[model samples]
Target: MNKQIIDHLFEFWEQIGKHGNFLTKENGFSFAKPTNGSWPNKVFDLTMEKLDIHALCEEIISEELPNSIAVPENEAIKDLLRSKGLRATSKIKAMTLDTTNIFFGNIDASEFIKVGSPTEAELFAQVATESFGYPVDPSTIGALVDKPGFQIFLGNHENAFPSCGMVYLDQNGVSGIHMIGTKAGYRGLGLGKKMTQFLVNQSIENQSKEVYLVASQAGERIYTKMGFTTHGVLESYSLSLH
Candidate 1:
């Protein structure tokens, strides 16, 4: 796995901490309580090399009540977790945009709106929830309004708020697309692709050397058409309480 992709994912979760509670220790154990029924409310970076896997799993089970554990795919860790009774529940691809040659369908720049205030941020969150079928804390979106290098864009189709996208640019010149979505009724309207292109263009304007994202299965094709190639796989494991 590319280190930049890994770091960007970690940074994405770290920014989620701004809205609620997030903890990352030097030992590499980290967790966030985004309270949005989102992936941020789980454990991350759990490599057995950094901590005792059994003890860590037990601790998360007892104290953290972790909904999942996300880590770069590793056969050793996967086998060990399976041996310990955990199973991978899902997998998402980590992809990087080919910044040198980006291509997206034509979209009028006027169709998208920049999310700059709390009210607009909340609207963006609502669109995300409607699109992804998961709760997104509006407070979390609002919190990013003032965060440096975090930008959110919302798309309006037929006078309705139907799509939203976010981009995070770290000081290290790595930019990541996050939480991009279009409402169920808005699918096939090219809103998502437009929002993505808007964010990518913004990142390029910010002088980002790399742009990446963890793409959902449904979103893989959209990104693929935009010249994003799979760089790695991130496996998500769920602990069976029973």
Candidate 2:
């Protein structure tokens, strides 16, 4: 529950969330980053001069996405890419956002979930695998927590076992969620719902007007039930270096 950890985790999620694989040079800065494939080709002209950003984008798309992907481009962009000896392909990044009705009713703050310290690596890994659909190693999850501003919250049942659903709070006024699953063999219970409501209430209390996350297919319904409308999807892509 350290404020510093909460701030750092938020910053890290922002940098990697919108930019995906692009490296950040500045510190303590946040911006409304353009999602994948939404950039104007002129951005390439400006960004590619020093960074092989276009190539990196291409590589990311090929490696991560192979179906229904097209990186948008204009004739000028095509020429620019061709001149650089790189071929161009157009693609779309699914982006969704809703601001009209984004709030969930307040719940009892006393019933809040308990957030453990940064050392709970195994617990973090389990959530990552089940909720986020990521095969994160325990060490990797721990390292992420070890980062300066990563704050994670865990929900427990009678202090015996984790009920699944951990919230990652960041400093960017955006709270992200991961590992939000009901415990195996405990499905159909309302544990997942309560945990989500707790986090949303907490995020709003912290002054975050909007919540964002990359939801899995199965978990999308849960988020929708919690009043989080789809903001948009960034079609992920990855290409080989060869």
Q: Which one is best on TM-score? A: 1
All candidates: TM-score: 0.89, 0.53
| 136-181: candidate 1 lDDT, tens digit per residue | 8887788778678788888888888889988888768778988889
lDDT of 1: 0.77
Q: Which regions in candidate 2 have their CA more than 4 angstroms from the true location?
A: 1-11, 14-115, 130-133, 144-149, 164-172, 240-242
| Model 1 quality (TM-score) | 0.89
lDDT string for model 2 (144-209, tens) is 443433445556555634454444456555555544565664557676677666666655655655
| Model 2's TM-score against the true structure | 0.53
Worst 10 residues of 1 by lDDT: 18-27
